[model samples]
Target: MVIKAQALAYFVVKCTFSGPQDLTLDEQLIRTPGIWKLFVDGSVAGKKCGAGLILSSPEGFEICQAIIFDFPLTNNETEYEVLLAGMKLARSLEAKHLRAFSNSMLVVKHFSGEYEQMDPQTTAYATKIKDASLSFGTFELSQIGRENNGWADALSRLASAKTQSLTGSIYLTEAKTPSIEKKECLEIRQGADWMTPLRNYLEKDILPPNRREELKIKYRASRSIIINGRMYHRSFSQPLLRCLNTEEQYQALEAVHEGICGEHLAGWSLAFKILRQGFFWPTLKVDASEYAKKCVQCQLFATVPRQPPEEMTSVLSPIQFAMWAVDIVGVLPTSTKQARYCIIAIDYMTKWVEARPLSAITEEAAKKFFIEQIILRFGIPKICISNNGTQFNGNKFRKFLHHFGFK
Candidate 1:
């Protein structure tokens, strides 16, 4: 005889922990190396109940999971459900060491023994966790909030009663929004190619009975032939070319170029590689070259050809105080109503630069600055060059420069 779900939940909680808010854990120990990680979060609204679990290897990310619960459960009970299931999952995977995280402070505190066992159900849950931990290499469970936990939060919401997360299905949709593009995964079905009929006719004694058409097919099939159900293109200089369907060809190309044991070959190398492996398709050479062209990883790591686009060309300044290059820098941080923009002038020969800050960059202010900083201090320049900004290009600033006889 089994008790009601609520009664069982209450009993488990009562056994494992007291209803006090004072439960807490000490500073977490240093995380063990090569330990697998598990993230679990539970959701309960009205009477609906659900849990989410994400397990990951030390090197790879996001090990997939499948979980479902029908019984009525509180948020804490649901959390316990997730925790137990996750731990069992870790054990089943033969994971030697494990670390689990949850958003439930009560569950983390109670299970970690920072709180007293006042509820039997809680006590039961905590006891189970202790027993389960010994089966793995090393196990630790800690608490985290929803902050910076977008994936776990989204997965949790998806598991609730109002929503169902189908595998690889879109969960949330905003109406009238543009759909996102997705990558295509290639798969090939057996007997879905031109060579299938030839293979069947030659190997399994299957044939269409139109004598004339059949004879033609047999004659053409002889030069580029099917032997023992494997299609091969006859070659005079080298070995026969074995045929592959879409998926097999893709995998073969990957193995040749970028597989775990691949050499990351160039286009011609890749084409020759498939031939050396005795695999063939009509577009084998073209496909290998195209694959190398479209390979994102190879493109990212490949050496870029580098050379100067044109011959060296630079204007040499004749003398000091003859020419000045002028520019303005910033709308920088404002302080005590001080200026934010700095007007800068560089002497072409001496490499000396003079700067003055102004609250505003304007034609009038720039004229005044030129008179004080350039005209009076450094004498007149043969050429005053500046970028075509409003302050430099305006008719008034040009007239001011003309008044100072600056070219």
Candidate 2:
């Protein structure tokens, strides 16, 4: 067994010290024919930021590019920026199979899906890279040590430093903005709206030529003011209320009536909440009501009214202090006195109320309250009504009431 172990150890050492003929599977695959290699690096020096890319063709032809960024970017963002630039260059060259190398472990892992891109900017860059990767037949990204990525790192530093002198073989370029910035053309057509007349009357003193329309615009614009180019309504209740367009009105209603802090309130309450939030539209109340009526969740789980279909008969007392209604009002939040229960008595005729707080509700406590608050202060009542609770209907309370000639 000793000889066998020693033989195995010697064989492993021999393979470990083997020549280039015994290259690992990864090394052999990386050197495969028709595979283009891309080395990317990014650098940020104080306020300046830049990236560098070195693309090597299978035929050993190299393309080195240095990009200086006009916008400020973080270290990881620069890494992704350079990587995306390199991929675009490779795609233009018609590279079918590409293997990218970066000294940034975060960039490599994010591209390979080992690390999640939590930052919004980096995530956008990662998404763009993945979409661009479809242009190539095969794509692979690997992380290398900073020392191994010397040439790309040097070019990135040079670009970041904005060195005036550089080798003629290195292609230089300037990026005015980030590669991920959206540049789609948007067409904005102006149409006549309510705010347009008011804004015009307030800002440019422009109004309709007709006498009636001109008078109307002048009257409306008198109640409106322009601050920082935005029209606001001069409100009576509030200092100023921001006016909303048709689109903004809908957004505000939806957000206030059903957004995260929304309670699915009634239309009137919803409109009031929006007003309190400093947003104003001409039809805010109507729009809020309509929005609430259309809410599926509100309708599905709405509370049904418990009112009688016919009519509710009224209860009457002959004279003041002749009859009293008694009830307990708590298990409320404990007060500083450690009292959590309250007993209340109300006269049916005059509607006089008497209340006392208690730490606990017991028969003795109920009886004591009845004598002190009811009989002592307002005289004895002819009839005493309760909810038939344990504290009010207990044997001791009944006996105490019986002793007092209460029927």
Candidate 3:
């Protein structure tokens, strides 16, 4: 039984996660590793249910470990059974170890031996998975929230669409508010001279047609190119050709293209242009200063915007009695004649914070307040901290602390 269509529609909206700030600890641990993290997610496509598995790591990312295979038409149980097909495929990676985190508690628990299978169909899947895991390296299964499993879930739907050869489409719309003056961007000015070197390299050398067309499509074909008879577009050929010319220049260009260009360019058009001639000779090699200046885009866009220095925060770890961070939050609208200030104290180690509403922020008021409200409570916190302000630097405050046997 397949729940593919219904599952896909529900999965599209259901699997979206808010962001990293919202992910739980279990989800975080699964994603944080630099190595491979295999994600398996399921969706409903009409009566047929589909599952997707994606492998991601420092090596790069790939989709299509497995997708929807026609199952006996029924419910989510068959959907889940079919989903394990991806896990069986995962065994081919021969990963040193595996960490399987899923939003489906039923699947997670059954695999972890926390839940027993009540359904016979699921029982078979459970048994097969046990054998599959043993066939691979060591493995651990953990339960994660559906919200945290979004990326995998998305991949699953994509895989299913591909597997079934279904015409699935995704569209993005951007509405620009009319500007009084349109923003002008600096573009690479390519002349006839730019094509001369590339032509010489491609025609003179025994260049692969795929390679030649790749570079030509990338660097050349967009605006206008005159051929023998007809006019045609060579988009992919030019940019890819530029990449093949010099290995070092290609790498540097690829870095800028993937990093800076990829971020700013939205739909089809590119925001930044990398001219073949602009890439200098010494820029390709590792020289101290010239390499640095070669990235004009970085010079323009990559510099961190200057910020007013923040209130210096102490990195001193919280210790039992060593360092402290203290601050005051006040100007209370609730304050009356009885209380005009609030004294706050925090322990550097324990994260213990103390606060008191004061009648005044005077030297005597500060001393008397700390002695009664704080010093007596936690003994002496060794190091007291406050912003460089008049309330703490006053003479009576110094004398009051001295009289109390504190530095």
Candidate 4:
């Protein structure tokens, strides 16, 4: 027979005539009770931070969570966050034993209790890790090669590169709250700003009892109101602007002149834009001016050349459906009823065209056309564009827009 000349070769998974002796690594893992395998990774690129975690149970079940951090973070800090998040996830799963793996040697050593955390930030992270680990009956942290950590590493890179957020096992988290420090929420007490007294009286109706102060508060508060716990500054010229608290004011300042959508606008334009966005802060003009001075991009990139007075000026629309251009066509040959001009309205973005035929193109006809065709049909727009035609520039049209909360 062909088998007569062959010699047997024994391997780990091979069975002998006596019995099965040795087991493969996979078989050994399956025999372990309640053991969960965890892999975690983190990355920071272009001032963005992301973390990824993968957990495998003894039954070969795998789950994942991909995290994206809005604020800046270092690689080690991100790694710690991933590890802590993974442990918490494991505890939630009722895992009593865990074998965690990571490519970060620093994290592995910290968790193994072989290294001291010298950095104050790292100390807090290590403490949290240690505290989270106590729930497990047995826990082991070790470092593996990057190749073996492909899932988590790839997940971290994916989260970092994602332009938009996704749902289900992936989340975009904003960590603007203070790190490694305990701070209280901003509270607006009296004398914080000029509007403090006005706020106290308007919301709480708790006016100071001095005769002069009470009169001043009453007069100033007549223009303000509380809507959904937010104080507002109202005007006949624009929509009601929600006054910002101290923390929110800082966020608005940063978002306006330097945040992602910021083009570093000038002080007046910046203040007006913030108000136009339906936000108001005390000392808006002064704050915007101060913040603009510190913007390096604006100092280097901004150059507003003066334009001719009547050279078809262009104003940028703030957002979608916020601006509309209206103009009158020529006084055409009279139809059956002598209808002359047509008032045409078009949205700046969507190009949705609307037109109204007019008998005389008088101010009254224009007003009725606007109220019916534009406001009732679509919605109120922030700005209405028109030339110096008396039909549009008349005082009545101005009052029409003002009463409708147009900007």
Top candidate when judged by TM-score against the true structure? 2
Go through the candidates in order and give each one's C-alpha lDDT: 0.68, 0.76, 0.51, 0.72
lDDT of 1 by residue, 275-323 (tens): 8888777688788888988989888998886878888777558788779
Which is the leading candidate under lDDT? 2
The TM-score measured for candidate 2 stands at 0.39
What tens-digit string does per-residue lDDT give for candidate 4 at 1-407? Answer: 11110111101111112211242225465347678888889888876677777777777666765566656678898898889878977886778899888889999898777888899888888877887788888888878677767657755764445342322332223444323332223342323766688878876779887999899889878888875345688877988877776667778888887777887786888888888888886588998888888888877888867886676856676577779888999778877677877889888888888887778888898889888888887778888888869998889988887899885
Count the clashes in each prediction: 20, 0, 36, 0
Q: Candidate 3's C-alpha lDDT?
A: 0.51
| Candidate 4 global CA lDDT score | 0.72
| Candidate that beats the other on TM-score, 1 or 4, i.e. the better one | 4
Please give the ranking of all candidate structures by lDDT, highest first, separated by commas.
2, 4, 1, 3
Task: Name the regions of candidate 2 deviating beyond 4 angstroms.
Answer: 1-27, 160-166, 170-172, 182-407
> How many steric clashes does model 1 contain?
20
Which ranges in model 4 have alpha carbons more than 4 Å from their true place? 1-31, 162-407
Error of 2 at 387 (Å): 99
Q: Candidate 1 local accuracy as lDDT?
A: 0.68
Worst 10 contiguous positions by lDDT, candidate 2: 5-14
Predicted candidate 2 versus true structure: per-residue lDDT over 45-105, tens digit per residue: 8877767677877876677666667788999999988898889888857798999988899
- Per-residue lDDT of 108 in model 1: 87
